[model samples]
Target: MAQKPLVLILGPAGHTGDSIVEGLLESGNYRVAGLVRPSSLTKPSTEKLRQRGVEIRAGDLKDSMADLKKHLEGVDIVVSCILAMVVLDQKDLIRAAKEVGVKRFIPCDWATPGQRGIRPMGDMKGEIRDFIVDIGLPHTFIDVGWWMQLFLPLPARSKREPEVHARVNTEYAGGTTPTALTDLRTIGRWVARIIADPRTLNHPVLICEDERTQKDAFEIGCRLSGEAESLAAKRISISAEEIESRFIKFKAASEASENPMAWEILYPYWTMAYVKSIYVMGENSIASAKKIGYLDAQALYPDMTRTTLESFAEWFYALEEPAYAHF
Candidate 1:
């Protein structure tokens, strides 16, 4: 038999990264190697991958250039699932992949179809996408759409006040704008399919579990979580223009603060930027994807069953505490 293509995954311990790892391993089609940072070696997910017979190589993305290049040796494909904040660090990674003659480079562009200019950090990801193209390596960008996990809400109370904490409150004030969303399980399968297909090379592909307005998603979550009746009167309602204005103000405050590094200012700026990008004009997400000849997840993998918002909400609320529970 001919040699199987060797696929190397970066940041394999992360949310999306781990999903991709599980999918690829389950497929049993290629020799999979996961490049994890030293800090991630102790993680339970990393240990699980190690036990699964995945060739685990430890190296840092922020540092370790020569080591990263060394690990890329004989690797036919490189799939990146790095976080948004550290996306720029892929510049060196692209150079290394090109130097090692890696066949295809898949960068972490997994979000709404049009992430460029939507947020400052998104612009940074766009820069990395452009750099990948400029480096002369065959590449593919996967736009996985909004994550379903973000819609789940949990009730909380301070000493003085009780409130519901959900990203939908901030991101989708006027929640009834068409939004494309995908669950992590679907993204994992879609990514594995992309890795197996040669036609996906050198383009952006949009994949989602389904498309529904943000309000639809919130309603699904509320109904499943049993908070629908009580939360009906507490829905947040804000206009798109107001969201834009808030984003601008937050950006200004982040820049003007004496300690811009402080979490107080930086957190709001980041949150506002992300909210503005997704919900301010979310109807455009699918439109932009189609303008670029977008490939749908169902069309790409017909045999694969897609997750629905309601089903996701049911599963999410069933958990003792959802994955990545944030205050």
Candidate 2:
């Protein structure tokens, strides 16, 4: 009998990482391992992964190249699902992967697909990607269009009452542009298949289960949650120029402010930039992704079950309060 490939994942306890870990474990095809911070070793989420038989290693992305290489030694594949704030830090990890000659290195690109300059976060991820390509690291880039978790309207008990649901008001330039949406739970399934497939080597893949305009998604949520009136009232629209203007303003503020918490102000606008790219620039759809040389995940895996927006909304509304709020 052949030995299973060893797959090491960074950020296995995170929202997206957790899903990916679950998918890999469910597939039962590889030896799963995670590199978690030493401080988080005792956390429930980390413990859960340990209980599931995952080989947990204590290390940080900011660790020295020698240390990272040690952690990556003998790993066949490395999948990074780390947070966006620290995406640029992946350079060291990439160097380590290259040094160790891992079979595959999957970067942390679990968001909408777009070119550089369209989104700040995208640019950060792009920097790591450029470094990977420049150094000739065998890799795959995966982007799941906007999360379905953020597609629905906030559930409300009554129109006259205050909003109690955890949903936030999403401001975008347009509502008619079609944007791809993917359930967070299903991302890992797509990733699992992509990593295992030889065709995805050194290619970018877009994982989109459902595509709908913002208006259409809200209507679906309204229909499912019985909060048409309330949801409709919460729709906030902004012009493209306004989005760009605010992005500039907040970005300047974030750069100029001396306070350490300056990111708090710029974070929303950074997110707004992403929203503008998807809803107004139309960069989140499969068409856009393909235009930029991304492999269509749906076409690649026809056997995989997709969680549609309507179905996700139905399941989302039924919950008293969803524990996983990506928005």
Candidate 3:
């Protein structure tokens, strides 16, 4: 009998990392390990991962390359799901992965896919990819257009005030541009398959289960949740010019502010920029992904069940509380 390949994930307890871990475990084809910060070793989340039979190691992305290479020893694959703020820190992980001869390295790029100027975080992710290519690391870049968790409208029975739901239901840049949507939980399933396949080696893969314009998603939510009139009435529309203007205004504010906590100003800029990229720029669709040289996961894995926006809305509205509360 052959031994299972050992896969080590950098942020095993995070929203994205946890989902990826779940998918890998469910597949039952690999041995899973996690590299956690020394301080997080005792957290309940980390303990839960341990209980589930994941080998946990104490390390950080910012650790010295020697220490990271030591931690990565014996690992066949490395998948990073680190937070956006520290994405560039993956340079050390890339170097360490190369040093240890890891079979594959999956960077933390689980968001909308676009070129350098499309989104700030996308640019940072691009920087990491450039470094990976420059150093000749065996790698795969995966981008899920946007989490269905973020795309859907809030359920009518959500605990938050109706105004909050209204804010989430706003339409940006005419809301007619189509964008791919993937359930956050399903990303790992696609990733598990991608990493194990030889064809995805050193390639970019796009995981998109469904594609719809903003208005389409809103209509589905309104129809499914029986809030057609109320939700329709609350919808707000912002033009592309307005979105661009606001993005520039907030971008300048974020760059000029000297306060250490200036992320508060930058957060709004990110939101607006994302809107511009997805809607105004129309860079989040499968067509755009293919244009940018991404292998389509839907075509690659036709056997896997695809989750549609309608199905997600059915499940979401039936919940006692909203499953994802980004609004």
Candidate 4:
């Protein structure tokens, strides 16, 4: 309940990590501690964090507690948002958070699909969460919903328009609806508010804007394409069973070690969490997804207005970010 501590965010230089830090810093709600690898000190985001006056500490995530404790000295919370495909060593960081006196720690989990549908994600994040709780470390599992920008139409390299090409044929669990998706751009700031509020505690808060849904994506995409006649422009209905089946198939393909399909493993969930959640229940379920215990980000930041998928899509390609230079 007390204001968030001079929080330390492990891996604060990465995409999701930087967004979280920016939100916290910009809110003027908490000071940020940036834990990054010595090699990454020169990273664009790390340099930017330093310029913004965040306490940036360089350390190896794989190092022993003695090596990482320095960064944790005065830290209240740890927010980690590393890319999984590239980074493998998070246990040391988790152990260090426990060994040190960090009050609450937020994990890198960004996909906030419905509770029932995210079983696979939990399977991925389960051990880390349990380990933290077992060590008596207060941990917050923040599931930011799907990254909608990745949805839209597929690239020229990939022929099928996601709208036209059906990646997952499964419908919703109840066999009455198709899975829904959310705009992930809305997630970063929601995470900031969650970490800022004491009531969020150390719980899994599924972060999504109030208007999050698969329909949002369909409507917006249709509008953007100027294809009112396109089926995606109009609301379509499928069963929950179909959605669940599609997700399960998608997950099985993702878990396939023999030939891991990259997009199947990562982007589908990012594109469908909201749709899954919508089928499971509805907008009311977003609170349970975020694990507010009894609070919501909107209530916490009364002045906050979440960006809709349509607005985010327009701005997504417009950001003049230095990290990514489109050739």
Model number with the top TM-score: 3
Q: Report lDDT (CA) for all predictions.
A: 0.75, 0.84, 0.88, 0.60
Question: Would you estimate the TM-scores of all the predictions?
Answer: 0.89, 0.92, 0.95, 0.70
Ranking the candidates on lDDT from highest down gives: 3, 2, 1, 4
Tell me each candidate's RMSD, in Å, in order.
Answer: 3.0, 2.6, 1.6, 5.8
Summarize candidate 1's per-residue lDDT along 194-285 as a digit string, tens digits.
87787788877888777887667666666777777555655567778888888889899987899875778877787778776667756336
- Write down the worst ten-residue block by lDDT for model 4: 318-327
For candidate 3, lDDT tens digit of each residue in 267-305? 787878788889999999999989989999999999999
Candidate 2 accuracy as TM-score: 0.92
Model 1 segments beyond 4 Å from truth?
62-65, 155-166, 169-173, 257-262, 323-327
Error in Å for residue 321 of model 3 = 1.3
Better of 1 and 2 by lDDT: 2
Please count the clashing residue pairs in each candidate, in the order shown. Answer: 0, 0, 0, 28
1-327 in candidate 4: lDDT tens per residue? 775568777667666777777778777878788877888888787778888888888887777778777767888878887766433367777777787777888876765434443554444566666677787778777665445554443222333344443432223343333322345434556777787667778766655554444545555545654444643433345676666666676666666745554664666653354455555555334445445343345556677786666676565434443113111
lDDT for residue 166 in candidate 4, whole number 0-100:
47
Best candidate, lDDT = 3
Q: After best superposition, candidate 1 residue 143: deviation in angstroms?
A: 1.8
List runs of model 3 lying over 4 Å from the truth.
161-164, 259-261, 323-327
Which stretches of model 2 miss by more than 4 angstroms?
157-171, 255-261
